[model samples]
Target: MTKETKKYNKWIVILSITIPLVVAILFGVKIDAELPVFLPPIYASINALTSIVLIASFWAIKNKKVKLHENLMKTAIIFSVVFLVLYVAYHMTSNSTKFGGEGNLRIVYFIILISHIILSIAVIPFVLITYVRAITNNIELHKKIAKFTFPLWLYVAISGVVVYLMISPYY
Candidate 1:
């Protein structure tokens, strides 16, 4: 990594830990003010958008559209950050909606939800490192990590929407 990219190493570690920790901490914090609008569906939509952008980015790179790929990747990251902000804001303002499905569907919901949560937290560093590699013009390493990062991030994004849909009725 270049000196400039090396600087991001500490930030990547800091953000990888701090983002999830802050989200978990904030999840328990409730404010008395009522939100003007519901946020779950909105954030879920953002997740869906992120997934789409991620897929597009993959396609862009495959088609040799390097600049398009880069731009789309950045857009995906922005969507994820926006989703995180909205998710935290919503959780702080409202109680979580419990999943109400029964039978095998309940099991499926939990399976997806658990995997989604685990991967969402786990994908943070991969994403940061992948982005750093790409932006630093470390193309070979970027491609290597992107192979892993893409799927994890895509699953996290898609599954966030799935979890929301599964529990939306309980809201």
Candidate 2:
């Protein structure tokens, strides 16, 4: 591995570990007083924006616009990070909104929510590894991993919006 890739590997590990742990801890925490209750819509919009950016990034690479693709991917990563921060903050301060759908819809919502949660966690490492490969100029490896990463990442993004929509009425 290149030195650059090695340098990022440590960060990848640290972020992959820390993000979920912190989010899990914050998920259980609820403040006694109310704060500004704007995070849900903002983070949901971020997730929708991320899905758009991911699709645009894919199109950029398909047209051989490598630099554009890189920038868009970077933006997507930033969106994800911002979304995480806001999501954790919202959960920490407010109660979790439960899904209020009926029987079949509730089941469907849970399925999507479960898959989104698991894949959202999985996508973090894949994203970091793909980003490291790209930055290190390992185009072959980057492309290989990105083929898997893109769909998973997109699903996580879109599902986030869906999950929010399903639960928003209860919030």
Candidate 3:
């Protein structure tokens, strides 16, 4: 196998095992009573920032500004990291937010929610693969997977905001 292939395969194994295990363990762990409440807007804002940066990164690459593109991608990754940290922190501390919508819009809320959930889970492997391809200098393969990754990431970000807005009332 090519060196890049071997590297990526190793990364895939590590991340594939690590992420889900972390999620599973974290998902069930209980926290202290009377946990501090975090403002959802802040986390939602991070998601918005991620989407904006992703779009800017796309524009940067389209213009062949490679360094700028890399910086933007790094910024996007940072935002994603920050978001995840806060998200898990919030969930661990506070009770899960419930959907408080009533009527037709309730359906709309759930639709957004279901899509958000499925896309969020789906995005994990895509992001890992996309990152691996880019880091390994497999630009051709990266670009091919990127077209899929970008939209899915965008959907996740946008839906994050949607979910926050929908559930904020109940929190």
Across residues 1-171, which tens digit of lDDT does each residue of candidate 3 receive? 587778778887787668667766886876885545564788899999999999999999999998998899889888988887777776666777778779998999999988987877778778888888887788999999999999999999989998888787887
Which residue pairs clash within candidate 2? none
- Those runs of model 2 whose alpha carbons end farther than 4 Å from true positions after fitting are none
Best candidate, TM-score-wise? 1
Off by over 4 Å in 3: 33-39
Instruction: Report the lDDT tens digits of candidate 1 across residue range 1-171.
Output: 467987999899999999999999999999988988899989999999999999999999999999999899999999999999988999898887788899999999999999999999999999999999987888999999999999999999999999999998888
RMSD of 2: 1.3
Error of model 3, residue 93, in angstroms: 0.8
Global lDDT of each candidate? 0.93, 0.92, 0.84
Full candidate order by lDDT, most accurate first = 1, 2, 3
Error of 2 at 134 (Å): 0.7
Worst ten in a row by lDDT for model 3: 30-39
- Give the Å shift of residue 155 in candidate 1: 0.6
